[model samples]
Target: MDEALELGEYLPQSFANLNEQTYLDFLWSALRTNYEAERYEFASLAFHLLYMSFVSFSIWQIRLARPGQFAMAMVGFRSEEEGSLLDCESPFKFYDRLKESQIFRFLKLIGCNNEQVGEFAKFVRRRNKIAHPTGTVFFNDQAAIDEEIASMMKEVRNIEAHMQPVIRELYHRFLRDSADPEEREYTVLGDEITANFVHKNYMSAADIAFCQGFDIDALSGEPLHDAMKDLHDALVALYPAEGDVEEAA
Candidate 1:
């Protein structure tokens, strides 16, 4: 959070060895680095990644929870010959297809409070204004930037807390239903659940950072070593082994 903090606190040495820098590194650098002269860019990048992850992964959670009719279409399927079954033009296009009405319906079915859905809509509107500016002044000063970032973080944390129990219960049901001897065909559903439900969705600290334009190598330094360590611990806590879905069998 400090303007001059070093990445040594968050990354590990092996981060340097990654073949190609990824969106994860981009976000990690933005969140962990305090580029003094680039404070505005750093704050914006960190906030954007956090907001983006919340929206996309929230939808991803829905796709995981409701594998019924529409959710299946959203999650799509990949085959050796057929390729992408859903034919999404782009990520934003995909989001448009999911839309608020669809997302709210999914949330209601999953027992999410109506108030939370309203808050989510408000947040999306705010994100739209930020992502596509029309003379909107985002931050007036360093203090304001920090305050806004903190506020967004609070919202993100609240959403995560609300989702945790719901997702857990749904997953338990999926596992239980999949394991019924009379429901062996449901095993494919389990496969779809596991294949589509990325574990990274559960661990915010380890969620991969993604953006449109950024140079990966130019962003690396000794500081990233510590951030990577923190991420590793987060992922380990979420899943100690690869036996997650299969173990439910």
Candidate 2:
């Protein structure tokens, strides 16, 4: 007999109240449960190991690439091209800009708060190390590795438990709230926004054209200015101001 059958046989009468079909269902369910747990554990271990390797690799890359200069350029801390050395300084400038960005706002709407987004960005950066590397040697530190893996597994489980319901609800709402045509438009718009912003300059002219093919004015048969005003109002309502900060006097 299979281990599952043997295990089922050993169960007490109360535990075995499941019918034959239910027993089969329980067996399959048990297999799936084990598989998911093992898969998560494996992924967690892999991620933790990758993160450790990333820390080492990132340090090396920084030394070789002189990424400090790149970071400085990105944040306008120093202007090597403009013959200026670290003059402009505003710590919150980048944060403020990110707050205003459409992509960031969308992410915020989908329950990924600023702190969570920062952690996700770090995870992506770590993932890049492995992706960009030609080769890597696996280092064994069993105890530490195991602990890191456990922590990662817990974190992943926590995230899934917390976010899965919210995501499901959002998906259900989208399906219910939108008509077929509106759903198609929303999907196209989402794809376009992702390709335009997330993928940077990777998209071709054809791809750009495909994304921009939808003519909102033509579809709605409304003036462009009126459509824009409506869009602005919707956005403002979606992401309302936090406090009673008065406008500049």
Candidate 3:
């Protein structure tokens, strides 16, 4: 009981304005939003991680094939204390560490075509916006909310179209080159990788597409489509419609 009372001392003075039930309501809302927000954030992260893994693997292969070339090209990424290397493991951090132009140049060196390099930059930028904190509140107007949803779906499709083929080709090439003919998993490597990644990471269809030989169209497939729709509906319900806000006002 004393510990509980001590915890109360840390509560903000502004919270005193709210009744206890209001506090409970706020807690419940936070709980709901936190789950939904995490799911949404992680959905994007699935794609981001898969993309990073592909790039990292390709970079490793480049190092294996031409040790001097990869190192020489990465000189720009080097800092005063650090040598030319992408220190961060995550795609977003790798992107942040290097200038956009530098990243594009490095991608070219590593075998990404001009179009693939541009698409990758765009995809990473979108992922960064999603990952970073933005103080913008949810739209209280229905039309605005609809617009926001449309924007999200468009971004989703953009990521799908641009990154899927690139990732597919990368993994396909990797497996083709790296897999041993005698290994049992050689023939089913794609399916094995897809299953493991999806099970372990709760990866979205987009994440699995590279290994599964699918595309953004998979997003509209049965299980994924229903799951995505449920998440979307839940998120939409969290925001107040224009009429509801006016009524509250």
Per lDDT, the best of the predicted structures is 1
Can you rank all candidates by TM-score, best first?
1, 3, 2
lDDT of 1 at 119: 61
Question: Per-prediction count of colliding residue pairs?
Answer: 10, 0, 0
Per-residue lDDT of 129-245 in model 2, one digit per residue for the tens?
A: 545554752223344335544444443333333333333332222223332433334454344233322122222222222223223344344334443333333323332343312
The TM-score leader among the candidates is 1
TM-scores for every predicted model = 0.48, 0.25, 0.35
Give the backbone clash total of model 3.
0
Q: Give the Cα error of residue 152 in candidate 3, in Å.
A: 3.1
Q: Which residue runs of candidate 1 sit more than 4 Å off their true CA positions?
A: 2-21, 31-38, 69-93, 96-105, 132-136, 170-249
Candidate 2's C-alpha runs over 4 A off are 1-107, 131-138, 164-249
lDDT at 10, model 3: 18
| Model 2 steric clash pairs | none
Cα miss at 181, model 3 (Å)? 5.0
Global lDDT scores for all candidate models: 0.43, 0.33, 0.41
Per-residue lDDT of 191 in model 3: 44
